[model samples]
Target: MAAQGVFITFEGIDGSGKSTQARRLADHLRAIGRDVVLTREPGGSPGAEEIRRLVLEGDPDRWSAETEILLFTAARRDHLEKTIAPALAAGKAVICDRFADSTRLYQGITRGDLRGVVDQLHALMIGREPDLTFIIDMDPALGLARAKGRNGAEERFEDFGEALQQKMRAGFLDLAREFADRCVVVDGNRGIDAVAADVARLADGRLG
Candidate 1:
């Protein structure tokens, strides 16, 4: 059967404010009477949330790129089975902070050329993509600063430092082009309200 709900995801380098934008979009949709579920990965469902700490709270080199791919794919599969699929089946809009696109870059190119492995695992396990994605583009250096300033436990990825963040920013832009039909590159260097406004406008158009 055709899916009855909308699946929207936000992607960007750490601290690009995609998370905030995702929340705003979900709240906006819900206020308008749409059933919305806001979630994130490598942790969405119960099992996935457990995996999130393992992947996100350790040292930067704690997990090899290959190992991270397997872990992330496992978490994604659980999230789909327990959260995303059910929400869509129930005709609710699902706004995800990050999805497979993140794995495709983080585990795909960061340590080495492992994107093919990530893709294969995804196809074998998760086998889905967001219907709409907002790739929040930002300056890598500034984004890294902002991310670290939060002093969050999930600073493992941020600890990879500016170089990795630069690579990630470029990788996200490339993915936006590669998936242009469903991806929108939003300038996240702007103020929060401005960025959120653009996001809401684009999302409303799509949801309409």
Candidate 2:
């Protein structure tokens, strides 16, 4: 029988360095002789990647909270069907930069009070959750500044500005509390190496 694979996700307000940490952890796991498949939500599969551009590249007000919830769910369903599930079935550790938890916040809370809608759609279309999640915590202003510095096309969320990030930070913390068993919060205020080290250690405990 194939060894069981693990589903891991990194989440935070934009520019919390969760993506960097996710990459580091994937490298660490690979270096330790484990099979790892590093991916990201909203764009893991080709179909989802198309959706990613639609949702992430447009104006901040381009889509309402309800519409975005639908778009994200569609993307996530495609991602799971095309990428995440196949890798996990093959017994490869799947490391994702972001996942459903992002929708739970960005649309569920920050954009509007539609957690119920997001939850209902998630339960219907995407029924999976990460086995382990790292919530990189950081100051909203700092994170927004870092995100803006990237000057990337996927700046719709960043354009929402620091206030949205602040709400997102708090919402993520609340989510951590709600799902304490799988969610681990890491301070993102220090050096990348320091944060990566902590993530690797925690992941080791679970991946063992």
Candidate 3:
């Protein structure tokens, strides 16, 4: 059956304020009486949460690009079957902080071709596209600076240097173009309120 509820995803490079804006958008929807559920990929369901640790906490040398992609797919499958699908089935709008696009950007950077990875994810889990995806675009250098300023600690991926981050940023823009129909590229260089306003507008259109 076609889903009755809306599924929206937030995407961006690190420190693009996607999480914060996603929460704001969810809150706005709830205020208007829409059934909303806020969630995140790589760490939404119980099984996915466990996979999140394995993906993020391990030593950089411990995992190859393919291994990282596989782990992400596993987490996504768990999240879809256990959390996302169920919530949407119940007629609740699901706003996810990060989704399949992350893998396309990160894994794509690690392993040149991302089409195969995306195909694998689609095969493993039912191909479910977000009703709307807000891609908060920002300069890699500025975004990383914000990330570093907010948190002293760094994960395996976050520890990557500027060049790598630039590549990931490019990947995000590329994916946004590839999925233009489903994606909205939000300018994230402005203040949080400005960014949140764009997110609110997008959610309002979808939820209405």
Error of 3 at 149 (Å): 2.6
Cα displacement (angstroms), candidate 3, residue 164, comes to 2.0
Clashing pairs in 1: none
Q: How far does residue 67 in candidate 3 sit from its true spot (Å)?
A: 0.7
Q: What does the lDDT read for residue 122 in candidate 2?
A: 95
Off by over 4 Å in 3: 1-3, 152-154
- Stretches > 4 Å off in candidate 1: 1-3
Which window of ten consecutive residues has the lowest lDDT sum in model 3? 152-161
Q: What is the C-alpha lDDT profile of model 1 across 69-160, one tens digit per residue?
A: 99999999999999999999999999999999999999998779999999999899988888999999999999999999999899999998
lDDT of 3 at 41: 77
How far residue 91's Cα lies from its native spot in candidate 3, in Å, is: 0.6
Instruction: List the global CA lDDT of all models.
Output: 0.93, 0.93, 0.81
Backbone clash numbers for all candidates listed:
0, 0, 0
Write candidate 2's Cα lDDT for 97-200 as tens digits.
Answer: 99999999999998889999999999999898899999999999999999999999999999988899999999999999999989999999999999999999
Superposed by TM-score, candidate 3 places the C-alpha of residue 74 at a distance from the truth, in angstroms, of 0.9
* Candidate with the larger lDDT of 2 and 3: 2
Per-residue lDDT for 123 in model 3? 69
Instruction: Name the TM-score of candidate 1.
Output: 0.98
